[model samples]
Target: MNKKIINKYTSDNQASNLPDYQQCYQHFKWPSVTTQLNIAYQAIDSHLNTSNENKIALRWLGKQNQCVDFTYRDLAEQTSRFASVLNTLGLESGSRIFSLAGRLPLLYIAALGTLKAGCVFTPLFSAFGPEPIRSRMEIGEANVLVTTMSLYRKKVAKWWQELPHLKAILLIDGAGVLDDGCYALSKLMENANAGLPCVKTSPDDMALLHFTSGTTGKPKGVVHVHQAVVAHKSSAYYALDLHATDIYWCTADPGWVTGTTYGIIAPLCLGATMIVDEAEFEVERWYQILDQQQVNVWYSAPTAIRMLMKAGNEIRTKYDLSHLRFIASVGEPLNPEAVVWSERVLGLPFHDNWWQTETGAIMIANYASMPIKPGAMGLPLPGIEAGIVKRTNKESEQATLEVLSEANQIGELALKQGWPSMFRGYLHQNEKYQHCFTQGWYLSGDLAYRDEQGYYWFVGRADDLIKSSGHLIGPFEVESALMEHEDVIEVGVIGIPDDIAGEVVKAYVTLKSGVIPSEQLQKQLKGFARKKLGAAVAPKEIVFRQNLPKTRSGKIMRRLLKARELGLPQGDISTLESDEQ
Candidate 1:
C-alpha cells in the first residue's frame, strides 16, 4: 500500500475532517476472495518483500539484562516453522490454540503463527494463578497450548486432564517434556519445515478469542474474526500516530486486548519497531528504557501512571526522555490528576482512550494533532458511531434503545453496529451476546456523557454507579477528587448501606509514605472532598487502608471492596492484584 492510500484509510496525523463510518470502511483495502488475509502475513510476510524485511520488528529485553532482536525476516521464518510444527501434529486448521506465557519471543511467535495457520489464538496472562488459567483454557476449548515448563507445572499440570479437548502441549522454554503428548518447542521448530505457506482463510474466519470478566459468574469469551485486522491497522495509525521509523513501547501485557492489538498487531502491521520488556514495573527502570530505547510512542495503563506519580518527579531528572513524543493510557478511565501531572513533570500529557475486549480495537482516542480535554475520552474513531443512549425498558429482555440528544446527559455509551472490529459473539453464549445489543446499537455497559465539543467523558461502569439519597454518583469522580489531596496515594470509593439514603459514599484511602492516618487528618480530607465536591456527592465515610483491591491490569475492583466491606460473596478473586485487609 502506498502512503497516500494508507493515509486515506488510516487518517493523517493532522486535525482534518474525519470520514464517517461508511467512508472509513470503504477506504480500507480488503483482500481478494482467492487470497488469504492472515494477520501474520500482514505483519510479517508482506514486509519481507519490501525494504522492511531487515528492519527490527521486535526488541526484547530479558530480566537479567540480556537482549535480543528479531528482524521481520527472522519473524517470518520462525512463525512459518511454528505453523509447520502445528501441521505435523495432525491438528486441524480451525483448532483453538492458547499461549500462557510471559512476553517472550516464543509467545509472540505462537500468537502470529497460530493465526497464520488458520487457528484461533487465545492468550492467558502469565500472572494468573492456576484456577484462572485453567478456567480460561477450558472456556476457550484450547486444543494446542504453548507455555513455559514452570507455568505448566504451576498452573496447568494439575488440571491438564480436565481439558479433554487439549491435544498437544509445546513447552517453549524447557527440555524433557513428553508426557500427555507434550514436546519441546525448540526441537519441534527445528525439525519442522520453515517454508510452509500461510493458510488461506476467509474474512469471517475465527482469528482470536479474548476473555473478559463479568460482574457475576464465569468470564465471557469474546470472539473476533480476521476482518478485524482492518480496524487494528487503521486505529493504531490514527490514534497512536505510529510511523514506520518510530520506536514504540506498549506496557500492557500481551494477554490483554490492548496488548494484542497495539502491542503485537498494530505496530508491526505499520512496520514500527516495538520494545518488549520482561521486567516488572519500576519507575526508574521504565524511564531508563524509554530514554535508552528512544521510544517515540508509549502506550500504558493508568495504574502505572499513578504509581509513577507516587514515585515523585525528582527521579525523572536522572534520565533523558527527549525522544518520547507521545504517550497514551488505556485499561481504565485516567483521572485528570495524571494528565496534569504528566504535563508538569514529563512535558507530555497522556492521551486517554476508551475501548473494550469486545470492541477488539480502540473506539475512541485523543489524536496527537487534536486538542485534549484532560478527562475526556476524545472523539469516536473514524469508523465508529458513538452515542449516549438509555434502555427504553430495563425489565424487558428485548429492551430498545433511545439515543440521548442533549449534551452532558449521563447515559450508557453505545456504538452503532457496523465497525469492522466489533466482536462477532460471546463464545457458547449466544443469548448473552444478543443481550449486549438493544434495537441497533451495541450497549457498551459503560455510563458516560458527551459534551458539546464531541468529547466523551467516562462516568463509571453502569453497575458500579452509586445511588445516594436522590443523586446518582460515579465512583471515579469521587476517587479523582480524592486523588488531588497531597497526602493521598491511592483511593477507592464504594456505596455502603445507609439507613436514610439507602446507600452512601464510603472512601477507602492509602496514604503517601510517612503520612500518618489520624482522626484530625481524616477530618481534613473530608473537608477537602467537601470543598471539591458538594456535600451530597462527597464521601460521607472515610476509612484508612494500606492499599485497595485491584485487578492485575490496574483497575480498582470497587465491587470486590464493597463485597468484602458488607461481608458478601467475593466472587472471582482470580484477577485481584493486591488484597488489602
Candidate 2:
C-alpha cells in the first residue's frame, strides 16, 4: 500500500472530517450540472438576469487613451450578436474558432461568443509571427479566425488559404471593401440580431483549446471543457478574494491560458468589473492605470513585478494606489524579493500561485487571508490534491511513480486527476496524453517540494524549456528555427538567470565546418531567430561553442549546458560522450 500525506494548516475540520476536496465542494455553490451549461451564459447571460445587468462588466482602454465601458447587458447583447453572426456563417456546433488579436474588446467578444455558439475558442498571442500562428491553427483545425486587419495582412494573409479547414477570416478592425474571402466583423455584427439563444452545451463539452510547448516537440494543444467554469469561479473567489463590483485587472494577454481563464472568464463569472488596457508595459503608464482605474484586485506576472522593481521606488511613490487591496503574481514563480518588495512598496504582499496549461486553472495559490510565505507557492486550492512523486522506474517508458510522504523532499510535482478544470486531453495525441498520467496523477514536469505547512516551493523544470518574461520558449523550437539559418549546424538553448525575467533564453551554438563564429554571424543568427520564432521565443544571448555536451545517443545534454553556464553543481554525468572545452 502507498502512503498518503495530508497536512493540516488549520484545526477546523471537525464537522465532517472530510478531505479538502469534499470540504470545498460542500462549501461552494456549483451550478446544476444536470442542466445544460454554457460558459458564455454563466459568464454573461446569468449576470444579465440579475440586478447587476447595468453593472460594468468590462472597461476597455483604447490605444488613444479612449475608454469604453460595457455593462453586463451590453456584453450579453454584443456576444449574442457575434454568436448570431457565427451561425449566419454556417459554422457548425463544436467548430473551433481561433482569436489572433490582442487585449481588444472584439477579441473578448469573439471568445465568449464562440463559447455561446458551442465552438471551441483558442487564442494565440498577437505577437506570434506567421509560423506559430499557422502551426497552432492547423493543429486545432480552426474553422473561423477572428483578428484585426493589420494582423491578417502581416501574419495570416499568405497562409490563410493553406489551411483547408479554415472557412472564415473575420477582420475586427477592417475598413473599406472586404478582402477576397474575408468579412468585416463590425458589419457582420451590425447585420446579425442581438437576441440569439445560447447553445445548450454539456459540462463535458469541449470549450477551449490552449497550446503549450514541450521541450522536444511541437506545441501540444490542451483541451478544456465548459465545466471548467466551476473551478474558475471557486478559485477566483477563494484564491483572489475577488468580490462583485470590484474593479479588477489581470496583466496577461488573451492569447495565454491565464488571459482566457482569469482575464476574461473568471472576473466576468464573479460579476466583477474588469479593466483592460490596450498598451504595453510601461512603468509610469501602469502606475497611472492602477491609480486612475482605481483597481481593487490586481494580477500580474513575476517578470512585470521585477521590471517594476527595477523602475525604483520614486516612480511608484508618486502614484496613489490606495484603492489597491490585493496584488498577485503568476506566469512563473515569484521570487521572494519581489513578494517582499510588493509588501513594502505596493502596500500588499503579492500572492503567488501555480498551474499549467494542462491544469486549465490555478491549482495551488497563496490566499489573501492566509499568512504569507514569501517564496512558497502556497497550499493547493481547497479541492486540488498535489503531491511530490519520484519515478521509481526511470529506465522504462512506462514508469512506476511513487508519491513521497515526507515533507520538503525534492521530486516532480504531481496533481490528482479529478479537478473540474483539468484539461481533458492533448488534442490528437492520445499516447502523449496517456503518458502524462500515471497511478491516477497528472505529472507536472516541474520539480518542487512541499513543506510541513503544505506550502509548495518551486525548484526547477524537469525539462529544458525556457520561461522568459512569462512566455514558455521550447529549446527544441528555437533550436530548430536557428538550424534553418545557413551558418548554424547545431545549437543548444538554455535559460540563464536574470534579475528582471526569471530566466532569459541563451543559446550556445556550434557553426558549420567551414563557417567561422564571427560577431557579424552572431548578429545575423540572432536576427534570423527573432524573425523565425519571434522576439519572445528568440534567444537573448548567443555564445559560440566548439561543441555541446551530448550523450552517446547524440541527445544534447541541456542540463550540462545549463549547469556549466550557471556554474552550478554538475550532478553525476557518467554517460557523457564528450565536452567542447
Candidate 3:
C-alpha cells in the first residue's frame, strides 16, 4: 500500500457518485427550477407525493437508550402544523425565529416549519451561557424563541423582557401552565392544522441566519438564502457521497453551520436517512451506535477524531464498523496523521474537505471517487472556481486581486463571487460585507498554496501567519509536523514577540494519556519538531498544557492563545468551547 495516496478504487466492489472527477466537473448542470422555491418544500413536501414519503427521514437516538423515528410524511405534517402555529401567532413572513435547544425532535421541526412559513430560522448553541445567548438574540432581533423549560429558565428568563422585538417564547416540553408570553408547543401543535400550505418564497429570500464569532468584535450574523439548498443538495451528493438509501450520521450540533447545512438540510433534501444522537462524545457509545445503526456515511470534526485517537486503538476492534463506507471530516483542516490513522485502524480513510460559514457549503473536497491526499483540501466542487490570489492594493475600493499562477506559492484563498450558498451579507454590516469582495472574487481571509497537481494546502489564517527573520511560516505546518510524534495528541502553535527575530514560533502541546509532563519530555518533543520543521521554523519555546482553548466547532483558538500569552484582552469568547488554565 502506498503511504502518500489512499486509492479510491481498491477493488471492483467499490462504488461512488463521481467515478471520474474531470468528466463529472465538466458536465455538471444544476436542475432548472421555477422562481418560487422554499427549502422546506425541497426537503419534505416534494417527497410527500412520492413513494419516499414513507421512508424514514430522521432516526433520533436519545441519551438514555430511547429511539424515535420520523418519516417524510410525518415530518411534512408536523412541520406544516408548526407553520400553522406560527401563522396563528400573527408572525408574518420573514419573521426571525431563534432556537436554543439540544438535539430534540422539536428543534428540527421548528427549523423546517420556520422555512415552510417563509420565516428566517437561526440556531444558538444550547451549551452557550446567558451572555452569549443574549448578545445573539439582541443582534438578530429574534421575534420568537423555541427552547426547553430548563434552558428558558436558566438562560433567557431574566432578560426576555429586555429585547423589544421578542414577541413569544415557545416551550418544546412543558405542561399546561406557562409564563406571560410563553406557549407550549405540544398544545399548539395539537390545535394547529396540518394542511397549511408552504408559503411561496423567492430564491433570494433569507432562510437561515447563522452567527459566527470574530476575534475582536461581536458575532456576525451570516445571512443565507433559500436558494442555498441547491448547493446543499449538490454538494452532499458530490462531497459527502450521500444517497437516498444511505443511513448517514453527521456528528455536529445544529447551532454550527456544518450541522445546519449537512446535518439537516443536505441529507433531507437528498432523501437520505439521518441519524441524530442526543448524547455528547463518548468512545464506547459512538462505536456502539456505528455498529448497531449500520451507518453507511459519517461526517464529523477533527477534535472528535483526536479524542477518538486518544481513546486508544484497542477499543476499535471491540465493535464492527464494517457498515461504514465513506467518512468525511470538516470544521478544521484535518491533520495528516489522523487521516492515516483512520485508514490503518478503521479500514477506510477519511476524506477532508474545506468550507466556512460564509461559503455556506462545501467548496473544496476530496471526492468519494478521488484518491485521498492525507492533508490536502481536494479540488473545487463542480461549479465552483477557487484560486490562490494576492491583493495588490491595501485599500478596499482600490484593491486589485491577482490569482497566483505558480504552484506552491502562498496567497489568500479566493472564490468566484456567485455560488448559491455564498452568504448574502453580514446582517447589519454592509461595509464589512462589501470589504469581503475584490475584483469579482470573495477573499476568504485564509492563506493557502496549491501544489503542482492542483491540490490546495492550508497554511494558517492570514492573521495567524508568523514572520520570523523575514521568513513566513504557517502554524498548521508546525502543528502537523509535531502531530507526527507518537505521544502528542494535540498541538496549538502561535508566534510570540521576539527581540531579534521579530516573531518567534511557540507551541503548546498535549500528550497522550498517562504521559507525565517533564522537562526531558518537553526537550525531546522540541528536538523532534526542530528535526521535522527545521530550526528557524520550529518552536523556540514549548509549553505542555492539559487543554488548549477551542471554539464549539472544534477550531483551536490561536488568537486567544496569543492574547493570553501577551496579556492582551480576550475579545468575543462567546463561541469558546473550552479554556486552558
RMSD of each: 12.1, 4.4, 11.3
Candidate 2: tens digits of C-alpha lDDT, residues 415-519:
988888989999999999998899899999999998886779899898887888787888888888888888888899999998888889999899889888888
The Cα RMSD of model 1 versus the native structure comes to: 12.1
Q: Evaluated with lDDT, which candidate comes out highest? A: 2
Better of 2 and 3 by lDDT: 2
Collision count for each candidate, in order:
0, 0, 0
The total of clashing pairs for model 3 equals 0
Distance from true position, residue 193, model 1, in Å? 1.4
Deviation in angstroms for 80 in model 2? 1.0
> Positional deviation of 12 in candidate 2, in angstroms?
22
Better of 1 and 2 by lDDT: 2
- lDDT scores in order: 0.83, 0.88, 0.87
Candidate 1, residue 243: the lDDT equals 90
Residue lDDT tens for model 3, 1-581: 34334343233324364458888888876666559999999999999889799999999999999999999999999999999999999999999999999999999999999999999999987866565678789999999999999989877898898899999999999677788999999999999989898999999999999987543456689999999999999999999999998999999898778888998999999999999999988999999999999999999887778778889899999999999999999876777778879988988888999998899999999888876777788889988999999999786458797899899999999999888899999999989889899889999988999987688888867777665543445677678778889999998888887643557899999999999999998899888876555575678899999999999998899999999999999999999986666
Candidate number with the higher TM-score (2 or 3): 2
